[model samples]
Target: MLYVKIHELRKRKFKVAQIAKELKVSRPTVYKYLDMTFDEAKAYTEQPLGKKRKLDPYKDWILAWLEEYPHLSSAQIHDWLLERYPDLVVGGSTVRTYVKDIREVYQIEKKVMIRQYEAVPEQPMGKQLQVDWGETKQKTTDNKEIKLYFIAFVLAHSRQKYMEWQARPFTTRDAIRCHEHAFQFYGGRTEEIVYDQDHLIAVSENAGQLLLTTEFQHYVNEREFNVHLCRKADPESKGMIENVVKYIKGNFADSRVFSDIEDWNSRALQWLQRTGNHQVHQTTKKRPAEVFLLEKQHLQPVSSLLSYESTHNQSITRNVSKDNTIRYKSNRYSVPLGTYQTMSENLVWIEVKDEDQKTLVIRREAKGEVIAEHLVSSEKGKLIQNRHHTRDRSKGVEELKQRLVSCFEDQGQAAAYLDEISQRYPRYRRDQFAIIYKIIQQYPAFIDTVLTKCMAEKLYHANDFRDIAHHLHTLRDEPIEEGQPFYTSSPKHSHIKASTRSLLAYTSILGGRA
Candidate 1:
């Protein structure tokens, strides 16, 4: 009816609105159905005798072409067939499905079977978690080669998965830390965690008596989590997480470009909630997020004031250089001058992040006064002599002047040298000077002497401290009167006379008298 209206309107040169009114239909209806309603002139008439061509003759050639170019589409195959088999009577649409069927029959195409998975009857929510690592090649901004490992953890009952990347090489520490992070991420702990017999956490590969790394076992027991090793060569024991590993690699890692591991994980986690978690599980026919939300209620509550060492722990020992600087990474970090008076030796806990293996040392003060503390790395540098001070928005230079005064309060004459540095480098703020103060604290005994020497030599840059320290070492050990050195009477002379006057003097002074 719409086509008839359009045809009539076209014949009479009428507008579509007039045609729609005449046809008792909306203008859009008339326009939408116009093409379908309009009749097209036939190009040929039906004939009793028509030519028929069978494609069976070209079947061998088609099969050979398909074998050579397995990925070629049906239209491409049709064109190629038309070039040689002009008499072939196969439509492109039909040819495509035929080729697809042939590939399937030959097992050339990958087959995905959706098999039902039966949940273990004894397994309960918050009972078990599976852990695995996924790795892929990556390049950093500095063109450094790196392999990115995504640590994936999934709860058995909820199927709630957590994935994050490791910065450092995979080790026992990394595996244990991954579990700790996953527990904290989920906001609770699981009763048991399943694992593959990977060397990172697994100590030995005895089938029945699998031995987990001591460190890993300790972490689990401390957290009240049990360890369950999956059967070797059988991923089905922890099959849920194997599927998760594949999903994260394909859906998260493959679809994104990342400059850093954190950025990659952030995007992956965003997609995890936005896409993966919300989607219905293939076998369970239930959304994982919904199920996980329900399972979270069953999770064991974390105890208040739980005492545990950091998962990423490293030891820091106190050492004050003769020049009064705390040594770390062969570089010096400063503390207050009188800090040594409070304690002879101090143990510091350093949290080493696996992603970059970067260290963060915690500092605590007993009083309100600013004391010696280790400065954290802000950038890549061996020594940062200059202190870091935030810009004073209100008092401005006055605040800096006060900081300089504080440094002077700690070191009397050394204050003049710091004042000179502040005068020379306007950009050097109080915080930067505080770093110097920290250095002073670490090496209080020698800090004053070193500062005096540095100022006398007009050494301002922090990097110059290394050279000055080396020069000071030379001066301190300047070989007292060479040839007549302490060992001069050694060789057979000392054995010949045990009570010689020179030997007696040396023995009394050196406290080596027998």
Candidate 2:
């Protein structure tokens, strides 16, 4: 404006001094502006509105980045400058201004990304409910940051939401509690509950086969609700609850001062009534709580609340001894052998199998698989055990080996050969010993010959020993005629005939003829 006004005043024949005083400027500034031509003045005005900045050296680089990634923010560009040029000396604000100026000069627009979502078919009322868990950090009233974990539930058709927060991470038991609370709030549950493959719910889902944790599996069975676990990394499958989780974290949890967990949960409930369930959803264009009114009639009535006190706490931890026995009220009850292999501390659960408390049951740590169930004995200091739990003493491998060696004429040689076979097949050494013992008993007469042949041929494998023994036994049992080959010989070559000659003539046909 000053440059154009200087020219305009001069064209009106105003003196340079008068123009300077009228424009409220110094004489040097007015003289500098008066020297510019109209074209030069227009070019000066066209230039980007900023003085030479400290980031002039990186103007081209910044312009290239903005062109390639239009979504890049000023703070991101500032970080890039520090990373690309470690010795860079500039403040964040300076880089921000320079990036802004470059963007405006080049007309490079920073575009916002909009995720495209297809319209999913509306789920049947009371047929589907999406469940998800999320955690966020919120500063409490005392200005201390606390991370709170929460689980969110949303009815698919109505989008009605229910959420609960906890100070610590939620376990399967806690998740069950949250589920009961949600059921009580909604007055019912959906026929099928959709969820991410959360650890609290499922342990793994491979090839569409979902393996629910034991406690969760039992709860699902008890509630009689069909479960549909979503594929990993597929939030769109259960997007309604996912969005509710985000809404709770952003609208309810963000900038909201946390107090005790009870207060936080109370606050969350109030928010659900105020804005969460009450607000008109952007997609449905109807309030969730209002729509749920009609959908609630379709829900299945809550069967029974599996209270925390009723289940999962009746079993007591007991240490499993090396002999696979657990000490109970007064006796040592036996479990199956190898039960101690999986327990880190040899700890297992001993629960009363029946409500009458007449049957005692021992189970695994988490799977609740019953290991043994026995009739409770009233007498003290008695060993209550199952006959099947005993390790068989008659079929011990060492006993078989010792008995087999006693049968052979050269017991020392037999013991040494068996040792070599055991070493060669250590993984199945016991199995090999049993199989060899069976074959030896089958052909007691061929034992000397078979053992001798095996020793000579180094046939230490049980299959090889069996083959040789069977061959010799076959000859003794079913003998062929004298001078007869066991297998028929190939047919003579009668088609290509040669004249018969004496055996001595063969030598004459050789070099002996020379």
Candidate 3:
């Protein structure tokens, strides 16, 4: 009937657009049927719905993947194909269409068991905030892939949101810091902050006893806000934030090309302004920015004295020791090399995080740029050091050892002396070489004599060599110069009451007892 109507309309001199409007059909449809005879239309209607082509090669495996994992998304399937066969040349749309058809043919359905939910009344302004963590993969400019983690916060009343991203998984201190940043973005916080059972914040849910991590617990107490942890596996209780997580991943991050985390988040703010916050919400029928204007008036004021803002953070000062470490709770944590300017009162602030005190964060200033972070030691007086911190010292020790070996005339004696010192005092080799290097610089020729004496007597201690060199230097009244050959000829000083202590005394004394 429609094909005959197109013929009659064309005979009546009806324009394509006009005919399409009158018959409520498309202009292209009118043209297609207008040019077709009865026999041609019959053949067109009887054509096959689908045809085999390029994707037929992968049809079997694609069908198998869908049959095995019904929950796999088209994007995930595309990723898997690329991962399994790196040289597979296929577009995402091509795979999507193929997967859809394969699913229908194999009767593979993605089953979802929906739970019943009660209608939740809209929260009033400043009443509550829902927070959740999300992550996504993005392509860098160089076409390399990187995964980024983020924490998102949404106001329960207005749906105004804030987000922060980092390349690494968040620690407890990091989570608290992001919370403060979100609170500032929203101008203040709600009366209650909602969370899921994130291991970063909560230690355990012991029969309903919420044991929050110690760092976050301190922050909650100091910030004076209530915490609401959603029941495990029940995301519908905080469904608003869960939707926000999906919305962010799908709408913003999926289309973005990431250069770095800072740039990714910086541009996300513009997206929020241009689309996320400005668009009229489906439920509220108002822009989030406009609703937030009214909601900001109800938010609680943030405290500069207590909150961990960019300007101020409540951190305890610890003096930097000569070894470039700070002591906290009987353990020493290292800072970057050269962090210690002087031995006396050079300070860095330290904070212990997690309920078990598992982590330590150290900063150059109170809440300033982080210089070091470490796992807190369980044993007292343990040194928790970052290997990179002592890399320079390692290099310097190598150079010093080379220079000391060159200073000796008998190379065999010099190598043997060094080998014995290193093997005997492995941990203190650097300090030993440091003292020996100084003594060699002061009395060049005299050190050779000490080396020969130490080799014959098998004495490998550096301080003893230093004292013997000084004693010989005083005996000879000649001032030692750089290029002048130094020697001690007093035969009476050949083993003149050189003070010595048993090597076992060093290890026994270090056992923390007399």
Choose the strongest candidate by lDDT.
2
Judging by TM-score against the true structure, name the best candidate. 3
Which structure is stronger by TM-score: 1 or 3? Answer: 3
Q: For each candidate in the order shown, give its overall lDDT on alpha carbons.
A: 0.61, 0.82, 0.80
lDDT of 1 at 399: 63
lDDT by residue (132-194, candidate 3, tens digit) is 998888899899888899999989899887888888566566788788778778888889988
User: Which runs of model 1 end up more than 4 angstroms from their true locations?
Assistant: 1-122, 139-145, 205-207, 304-306, 314-514
RMSD of 1: 26.9
RMSD of 2: 23.7
TM-score of each: 0.39, 0.42, 0.43
Q: Which ranges in model 3 have alpha carbons more than 4 Å from their true place?
A: 1-114, 305-514
Give per-residue CA lDDT, model 1, range 62-127, as digits (tens): 667767766667788789888886776777776776555444323244234455767666458888
Candidate 2 accuracy as TM-score: 0.42
